[model samples]
Target: MIEKLAINGGKPVRDTYLAYGKQYIDDDDIKAVVDVLKGDYLTTGPKVKEFEDTVANYVGAKYAVAVSNGTAALHTACLAAGIGEGDEVIVPPITFAASSNCILYCGGKPVFVDINPDTYNIDVEKIEGAITVRTKAIIPVDFAGQSVDMDLICKIADKYNLTIIEDAAHALGSEYKGEKIGSIADMTEFSFHPVKPITTGEGGVIVTNNEELYKKMLLFRSHGITRDSKLLTHNEGPWYYEQLHLGYNYRITDIQCSLGLSQINKIDEFVKNRREIVNRYNEAFKDIEEIITPREDEFSNSGWHIYVIKLNLDKLTCTRKEIFEALQVENIGVNVHYLPVYLHPYYEKLGYKRGLCPEAEKLYERMLTLPLFPKMTDKDVEDVIRAVKKVVDYYSMENCPL
Candidate 1:
């Protein structure tokens, strides 16, 4: 029905708008939440523990602690790692601000590390040069569902005596070298946001094999208060409790955990479908010179949260914004994954400046996230591909100079 590109006064790809990511809730998910609502315990209840145990088992971790959300998981992990004032944490600049903000939350300084231009993860080689006596930990993000090189990162941590808290917020189903993500890092954090591999409305969990860190994080999520018999110094009566340390009210609700338990049952299917969509996108755009599809390391089996495309500016007549807006004009709801974390005004106020991570800053200029969710039908996927091709073709330059 369409003869020309929408950006050039032609018909658009589709009549409806498609977002980059979305939740796929079904009848089972609904029943789980409804069942929780009708149950006795609502807040800190049995379902939370069940969900935590299930996730821990799923990821091969010894313990798991469910928290209110992803940021809380990061904060709790930071506290468990002993981050505090005068401490420094190494993190990639090419990720969500929460990855770095978690360090700030713990009274520690966030040292911005550049990304690998090929994989868009933190450059592990650059991490060593950034380390100092104050450096306490490294928060390596599994950006866009791909796992980082944990084997090499572990060696770095061992040499420097630094902790590793994997911000695997996008990588619940991802794997590294045939091993699952949660079991690979010292402590791994997962998000259960609607847009993630699974949904819990708003929830997060931290998993670890270390019993000490697990115990520390458990208390940290509950206002530093405990009523446990072993933890209490003086059990004057059944009601007696103690505040072990300064912590936060980061506990997740049973309702969310109920939804999470249901969601985890279908995580495999969710990840498989996401991979199929990514494959389709890659094949569709393979011959398009103006676009470069995302790449994963050979060791990474990505969970495929979002599929991003990088623009070849020299080969395109239009700018990155032009291509992004043109896609929007064609009913494609594309987005940018992130701007460099330190580039935000708040980070600038904290005394960070430009030229901190040149690769990340450059990546921001060309990156554009496309629509990719498990709920998308075949037609929806085709519509996105057509929309992208139309926009790129309209703006492409055959012989532009770099």
Candidate 2:
């Protein structure tokens, strides 16, 4: 017999709600933070530098600058890239607003690009069509921890002489053609939010191979105030500094970096575990006609930040919202990954209208994020699978066209 859905007052798949993403904080992480708290310097300290160096080395980048959060990282990267008024930056519409908002922060216009229907990343082939004489850069996001086609993106950037600011918030440990995400782009930014692969309470970092850009980011994060004698116009004896540019106080605290240092030590294991869970999810849903699993490209090894599934709505008797709610009733904390950045009222007020990216808007209507985290046990994975299957089974239609 087909099981009754919990939304219809039947038994739930699980007793407790499972969040879509969560941080895995162990005793070691707590100890690392405590060690920093007990030390002399809590804000501008050795721990922050240590964390930055570790990340840079791990990603094979020449330099890394730690900042208050991911948004600041993007903003500082934009500032370092010399993005100014009237400059245009190409960005995909499927990502978080911050991806494009950074361009706006630098007084630049963001030209929205559509995503490839399969990868849900910016369509590389269509990128050149959006470029104009005003175009200055391209911000390619590695959506859902899958690397964008860096080789193709690099070729495009080189041809246009445009800088590539990779938003790698979802893809720290992900690799493109055997190279780490952070090392491929001109400047790559990573987030250390609670729900990210690692947690620093709230923090971010930008990695780059260019020393000029690295130095600029360093100055930008600390209010453009520099005590370095090489940078100062005129230095007085011992105590002297200069505020060369209008910059924000985006410095990250050592306390957060301490946690980040600890968490990063386990990143490989975390990524491995996430991939294992994704494998389980893929296998469980492969036979379900009403579900379309995420696709990882041949050259990309994803870190699997969040497992997203697109419903084959025609094969089911319900809408995505109905399935989402049904999964919630079954104690599965299903959620939408995002609405297109331009669809938000704020962007709409900025003169971005609908039909800008039909593919992104269509995908938005059918996509759902399932529970995915490094700490999720096998049972947690099983519960999510059972809940989704139960909901889809209850709503599935007969003789549905593929």
Candidate 3:
């Protein structure tokens, strides 16, 4: 089952399946999960604390709250940051839907901003113009692991008394302006989806320096029920509890925490391997005028969660669709990072037209995400490169320089 393609009628192609992203789980990770399975607490327990502490310490955040997934983390983050009804949260339309959806979950409206072409991130300069009396927060996504222009973003936030919630789902190990990203924002959310830099089988976390926000998120993550008697007006029993606020059961299991701990132990190695793959990709496509590779910010560091390349259609004989199909036929897995949030039929009805964000729209039309993960081998890299070159060559026959 593993050797055959799940699509295209299941024909055998290679010895193994090459996914766009995958986890590099070693024996230690397996053992950790197994140990949790054998332990008393399979849900929230000591391992969660250890995992949270590890993340907090690593990212220099004062506290971290593990949640069910990134969306839950975002929801809790918005709630913790005091985003409420009548509040307007400025968010980039280029991000995943959850980034904007979180604002709505907090009973706030989402004000969409356009993105910068080269970075594929929210345009910080364009952000200030969208602010209004109700504007309360700014959620800047670290698109594809590259840190956003935080210095300018923070500057704007300071200028407007706006709260900052970094959608760092793609940037766990990324840094900005010499400081780690999680520590920079008022609240930061991270994801551990299978395709992300790490895996916890759908886990997420909220990291912050504010104690009030941390406590609020903690309560929000666990059904808003509290066992501490101090918060209760009167203690009928020693087991008295309090419901301070409306919340959800967005708690993570100890099994996931156990896996996260193991994964964290090898994060450095995973990042190193990914960097090696990125270097290879950069070199392989360096001279190819048909694509534009991702660029790095001089003042920031990245985790490179995805390796997206923008197509240069002017020099190509094939359309984006044709090249994509050709690559699929050649057994290369391909994906588009996103369709602009505003282009979705739901948003279109909300008056978000095609030309609103020219830069993001143009980039969206041509971008393709190739296979990238720590598990990719030299042969896998070579195969992807060869497949891409073949597709480009086959489609651009007469237009080919040779």
Each model's lDDT comes to 0.92, 0.93, 0.85
User: What is the overall TM-score of model 1 with all chains considered together?
Assistant: 0.97
lDDT of 1 by residue, 1-402 (tens): 224667667778888888888999999999998998999988899999999999999999999999999999999999999999989999999888999999998899999999998889999989999999999999999999999999999999999999999999999999998877899778999999899999899989999999999999999999899998988988899878899999899999999999999999999999899999999999999988888889899999998888888998988887899889888889999999899999999999999999989999999999999998887999999999988877777677853232
On TM-score, the candidate that comes out on top is 2
The clash count for each model shown is 0, 0, 0
lDDT of 3 by residue, 139-185 (tens): 99999889998889889999999899999999888788777779988
- Tell me the tens digit of each residue's lDDT in model 2 across 1-402: 688888888999999989998989999999999988899989999999999999999999999999999999999999999999999999999888999999999999999999998999999999999999999999999999999988999999999999999999999899988877899788999999998989898899999999999999999999999999998899896788899999999999999999999999999999999999999999999999899999989999999888899999989877999999999999999889789999999999999999999999999999999999999998999999999888888888963222
How well does candidate 3 match the true structure, expressed as C-alpha RMSD? 4.0
Model 3, global lDDT: 0.85
Error of 2 at 265 (Å): 0.6
Which regions of candidate 1 deviate over 4 angstroms? Answer: 1-4, 399-402
Q: Give the top-scoring candidate (lDDT).
A: 2
TM-score of each: 0.97, 0.98, 0.94
lDDT of 1 at 182: 96
Give the poorly placed runs of model 3, Cα more than 4 Å off: 1-17, 397-402
Task: Give the lDDT of residue 282 in candidate 3.
Answer: 90
